[model samples]
Target: MTSIEIRHNLFDNPEVSGTEYKTVELIIKKLQIYHPDILTSDIKDGHGVIAIFKGKKQGKNIAFRTDIDALPSGHRCGHDGHTAILLQFAEYIVSGNRPETGSIILIFQPEEETGNGAKKILQSKVLQNLHVDYIFGLHNLPGYHLGNILFKYGTFAAASTGFIAKLEGKQAHAAYPENGINPAKAVADFILALDSFKNDDISNFKQITVIHVNIGEIAFGTAAGDANVMLTLRSFTNKGMSELINNVTSELQQLANKYSLKVSYDFQDKFNALENDDVCVDIVKAAAKELNMTTESLPEPMRWSEDFADYCLKWHGGFFGIGSGENCKPLHNPEYNFPDELIDIGAKMFLKIAEQAMVD
Candidate 1:
């Protein structure tokens, strides 16, 4: 199958985060052609695929992972780019030319963009049974030159937690403000409250805090029976993240009560910060250098969250960002395409990483 066509098939489907059946099914089918050993299994109602390749000499079990899910708007955030690179790499590995040593586990996880797939996979017995010693993954970075790898020694990406706050109030004529509990004011107050709590300085702590509260749809003619605000909170450290989330929640409650509006909040922990192990970094860097690919350390923690953090928690693993070049549009942009040249390098990097980890 043409890689472009595969990209289209995956890109066209807006698998979203929690609901990623279409894309996962397609990836499973594609992998089956090369590796009949591939298995399509479900994790807590959602699907996650796994395939294993044993080496000539048994040393340790190593896993290379890739996410097989897209965003809500579909093609945004370069999911298609990631799929293309991963598929290319999968093809390369299935060609049966790997070095002799530890076994390889190829994990095509779902809902990565949602930050749930890694956690779901971790909960499963498959990963635990494999006893994977090292985990390696990569993502496409939009702001840099494509095909370049940015690796960090410590935490590379921030922890992202998002949720929606639903504010319920009495709806009445706009003419009488006191007669009706207008939620519009509550929404405004919530926005102000979140903005006031924004912390942009990284030097104060391990990483900066990012808080975004955007007002969703609101009916103006009506007094506003319902109003909602989508909140995105991010920070480098788990403790900082906890504190930030608590502050936002508490402030929201106060604002809602002040306006006499009944409020209920549901917080979904989307993703945790991606912290890299130094040992994994050294191995991957050496692999990149040997392949003649330039590598650099990340300057600051990526404010965005990645589901890969879930994998890093249990396994000695790391995830790096591959530059998509300055000319390339930013991630989640409608006009985004994965650079084809980077596919080979990514494959080579993982292969080397697996080899190095499994060596006796």
Candidate 2:
């Protein structure tokens, strides 16, 4: 099938993270045509697909990874096109494109939106057993000319996590005169404390966004006994992320103590910063150059978290972006569309990168 056909098939049957059952089936059917040396879909995560293409000679094991799940609303992030691009690359390899030394591992990773797929795969020891030397993945970026290659030396994307603070205290009647403890002060202070981190003189970039807060019911008949504060914490580097978490935790703990409130903390959807290896970046750049594609080096790391960072932490990995188009809608937007034109461009880029990685 053509890349567009595969993309549309995926787009039509969009599946959310942790539930790419049908999506995985379609990917398997398309990849079966290529007959990878090893095609296994039922792995640790149950949704990740691993395909290994053996080389005529043993040398370097290069893995090309792609996310296969879409957002809950739909394929707002264009993962359908990502799957199609890697599938097309799989087809090219079977069409007499063999590696010079080591095998090529193609990963159709699931739950990328939830930041769990890569970690689960790693725990499965799939890539660990393969001893992959270099890994690569690409994401589509809007607001640039179509087919433009975007690259950065390090921290292509930031690390981010969702934090929830649940505060519990005694409730009393509204008419009570300081008869019971209230968590309102703690919640307010927590927000202000986190906000202060924005001015930290730390070397790493950091940010905190207060997404939500809940104190009491609308009845207004009773004093508030509980509160919840939801925030998104972000940092440009993994070290920075660690520091951010530490700072937030310490401050929140202090507030809970001062207010005599029983506070519980939970961090969700944690994504480590995407660190691009210089060597892998140059190889990708050379591959782009060979394809004669226009390339741009980003001035700063994107302020978004990417799960691909999990793979890079274990192996020499590089992550880059392909321009969807100058007028393409931002990702995750309800009305955003994955440009069909990107299918061919992404497929070509993936194929070139794979073919070149095989020999180099």
TM-score to native of every candidate shown:
0.81, 0.95
* Tens-digit per-residue lDDT, 150-187, candidate 1: 89887888887766788888877767756877677788
lDDT of each: 0.73, 0.86
Name model 2 segments beyond 4 Å from true.
199-203
Ten contiguous residues minimizing lDDT sum, candidate 2? 195-204
Query: After aligning candidate 1 to the native by TM-score, how far in Å is the CA of 238 from where it should be?
Result: 2.0
How do the residues 1-360 of candidate 2 rate in per-residue lDDT, one tens digit apiece? 688888888888999999999988888898888888888886675588889888778788888889999997899999999998888888777777766568889999999999999887777655556788889999999988898999889889989999998899988889892987899988878887777676334347899999999996665779988898999999888998898889988888888889898878999999999999998899889889998999999888888888999999999999999998889999999988888877767767777877676666
Best by lDDT: 2
Q: Candidate 1: misplaced stretches above 4 Å? A: 2-5, 8-22, 36-38, 56-58, 72-74, 94-101, 166-191, 203-227, 253-262
Cα lDDT, model 1, residue 229: 77
Question: How many residue pairs clash in model 2?
Answer: 3
lDDT of 1 at 199: 72
